[model samples]
Target: MPAFVINNHGGDTPDFDGEITFYVIVCVFLTAFGGLMFGYDLGISGGVTAMDDFLKEFFKEVYEKKQHVHENNYCKYDNHVLQLFTSSLYIAALLASFVASKVCTQMGRKPTMQIASLFFIIGVGLQAGSVSIEMIVCGRITLGIGVGFANQAVPLFLSELAPAKMRGALNICFQLFITIGIFVAGIINYFTSDIHPHGWRISLSLAMVPAVILLCGSLTICETPTSLIERRNFIKGKATLKKIRGTDNVTAEFESIVNASETARQIKNPFSTLLKPSSRPPLIIAILLQVFQQFTGINAIMFYAPVFFQTVGFGNNASLLSTVITGLVNVFSTLVSIYMVDRVGRRILLLEACVQMFLTQTVIGLILLTDLKPTGSWNHAEALIVVILVCVFVMGFAWSWGPLGWLIPSEIFPLEIRTTGFAFAVSSNMLFTFIIAQAFLSMLCHMRAGIFFFFAVWILVMGLLTHFFLPETKGVPIDAMVEKVWKQHWFWKRYMVDVDDEVIKEQVHPHVKYVKYGF
Candidate 1:
């Protein structure tokens, strides 16, 4: 066992050998489904938006044939209604995340998630059956509720259950699936474009499938060990720990979790602790990481890549096809992230990805600003270059900000504050989602492609901030991480000395190491 893992809380080592349990994987997979749904909803909407002209024509024909309708000219103009349609989810998510902050902490993680799934079913049904834009907007708000739930719930769940060695990697998988979901949705929309001039009701409606799966899967999975222990469900908590770890390792792991939770409960109220100076640094990191994640305008890319491609003069089929390429890049680069995260660490990936995003976005914006029209029809080679650059941006995000954004919040906070802390962090993220997405269409009309210049500046600033402020947290045990963060902050440094001394002793003294704090 690593020295740091043996001495900190109370001296004890968990059993090292045991069969791997599927319980944790099951939870991860189910929760990942929520991200997948979020992605699918995101990707499909973009392609649907790009098809606005075609849908208008199709709807026009239907209306004209029905009653020679003249008063309700639904197809006379392309209103880009799809843009608002795409953004509704973010608005709903912002609202849901705020509400979920209280709910997750009060009702517990599992039940809150169940409630989210209910919203998913309702939203998906409304969207599928919508006869007007108002109905679709209503569904989006409901769907947003589900997105808000997972945004807060999955990271908290994964961070609590994963062993120290694998926690960062596992937690990042939540982000990975989000990228995958975006990719899958893009691919499906492109392949279905011919049949989808009817407005992609099926593609949009399919989001309900994963929600149902998650609802069913949640039933089989145990509550988070942290939550189980908090409610004083020791036996079930032990059983839950065993299921996540293994029978042989359960005793030590459970004790560690119980100890961490108790230590946190002893200190202060979890929600109020977020206000304390001691908690401020990580909370800042958590909040800003999420803010940067959104401001990088990655969602703008995912939700509007198809429209951007079309605006540049690509054929309709070709524009949708380019979205599939973006998805491919997102998926493969995320796989690269999965490989390097544990080895290369979070800070490096984030820094490099941020720089790459800034450069690519700047170049893309410059290209859009050019007046060089295709000599004949739109130049395929020039368009393809832009398409490739856009894919490069997707790759940059998949490897860094996308996954690490979610990873930081999940593992950074103390146990007592984790659920509530994540709630705040996620709410911050969703709020940005609302701001960027809701205003994106209007901004594009006013600024044209130059709007990306704004995003370029946003990505550059975030990269620099991350370089200075983000802490290195790759393999640190969760319990000790809070104290370490306080030790490094200027205002908290003097007070953290004794705590720092204890940490050093644990590090330097081979006789003592961080013992697992059994839950």
Candidate 2:
């Protein structure tokens, strides 16, 4: 068990305060459907793009290029218009995240989620029924807006609803569901790929399944206690807290939430307040984590796994099968993360995965550089070795950056800036995702085997940053993080000193004081 260094606060750590209840479980499971929608889109696009029918119907030029027996393997799929079909959603999502922040803060997390589902449903319809390229791109843009809203709200909702001890595991349900969505989409694409003339349409239309589930689920889950209290519905907030905890003895926890909400109410402009020196740590950390997460090149792998396999040496059927194999590896690896996050702590998982990922990336790059050439294909045994190496790399990422990227950013902010801060993280993620998705095919053509080395270097930089700057937040309560985490860190502590002094002047309670942790 992790030890707590409690300062003047008379009670034990808030980590021990609440019991998990069935109601909370149902709520978490439902909210996690939002990730399903996002993930399906990620997995489906590449598979659909690889389908002969899809390319023939929408991208005839690329399809004709594929017919040339001597075409450069790396350059066969490099078309700007084709790339736009996969990348348009992320650009739309980047712009929509700001609007989501306002809706999430003003109306609440539930309504924002509901809106996300509705938009996704509309997008699925447009894409499934599309006859023209213009219609399909328009559908992708609509889906991006829904993805932006869901990404902004779901992580914050899970963090606020879970008990401190279970927060990491529960919040990871979002990532877990994302992996499941990818796996399910892979299965759908594998079976549907055999259906002539309309397999891609079937794959695109199936996205509505998760959106419909989210739409119905959002109506049943209660509003988060923190969100309720922040909106001044104190009576409902306390009642809701009691219901989720499965006990009426919620005075201490409820009081802490109320106090945090009161402090939040005093700040009128959360976005500007985020620019203050004291607020810099979480904000900067949140942004960097999102940026680094994308730089890992995980999205590039997930978005274009089918196309990538085809580029190496695999036939159309074999490439989709390899993608399915990688998808399974991703899902199971995320389950490992859910079990281990709170027990072993975030930093250890991150650091260890960095070592694992760097080695795998280096090996893959060397193999491709030495053996595989731009114009020829590798033998079956060599191709299998590359696939095995890719699975190992995917395993390393699935358990670390993939989930924690969203988890840490959601947990670190104070209530006043919570939604706004998360919006920045979401926007940063979407922007980088757009850049990578848009550029990966071209990069593959130009860089060839060297692309893996580029990502390996980024993995090294992220590991160094994690070691020097990131703090462990495993068991810290959401409301008490500023006192326990920021004020106690070696480098971040200097930034918090002035904020501590101001808190001391404004503090009304005798028991509350700055917490100092030895470990």
Tens digit of per-residue lDDT, candidate 1, span 1-519? 421243233443443333436767777888777677777787877776666433554344422332332322112122345456767787778778867866766677787777778888899999878777788888888888888987777778777777766777778777777777777888777766677445477677777887887788777677887888776677787777777777645554555566565554554566677787666777888899989998888887787777667656577688888888888888889878878887888999999998888898899878766743322234678788888888888889999988888887888787767777787888888788777776675676567667789999989898888777787777666655655555655554543324344544443343231232222
Per-prediction RMSD in angstroms?
Answer: 6.0, 4.4
lDDT score at residue 27, model 1, on the 0-100 scale: 78
Error of 2 at 134 (Å): 1.4
Q: Which is the leading candidate under TM-score?
A: 2
Which residue runs does candidate 2 get wrong by more than 4 Å? 1-13, 500-519
RMSD to native, candidate 1: 6.0
lDDT of 2 by residue, 194-255 (tens): 99999999999999999999999999999999889888787898899999989887767776
Worst 10 contiguous positions by lDDT, candidate 1: 69-78
Instruction: Give Cα-based local distance difference scores for all models.
Output: 0.72, 0.89
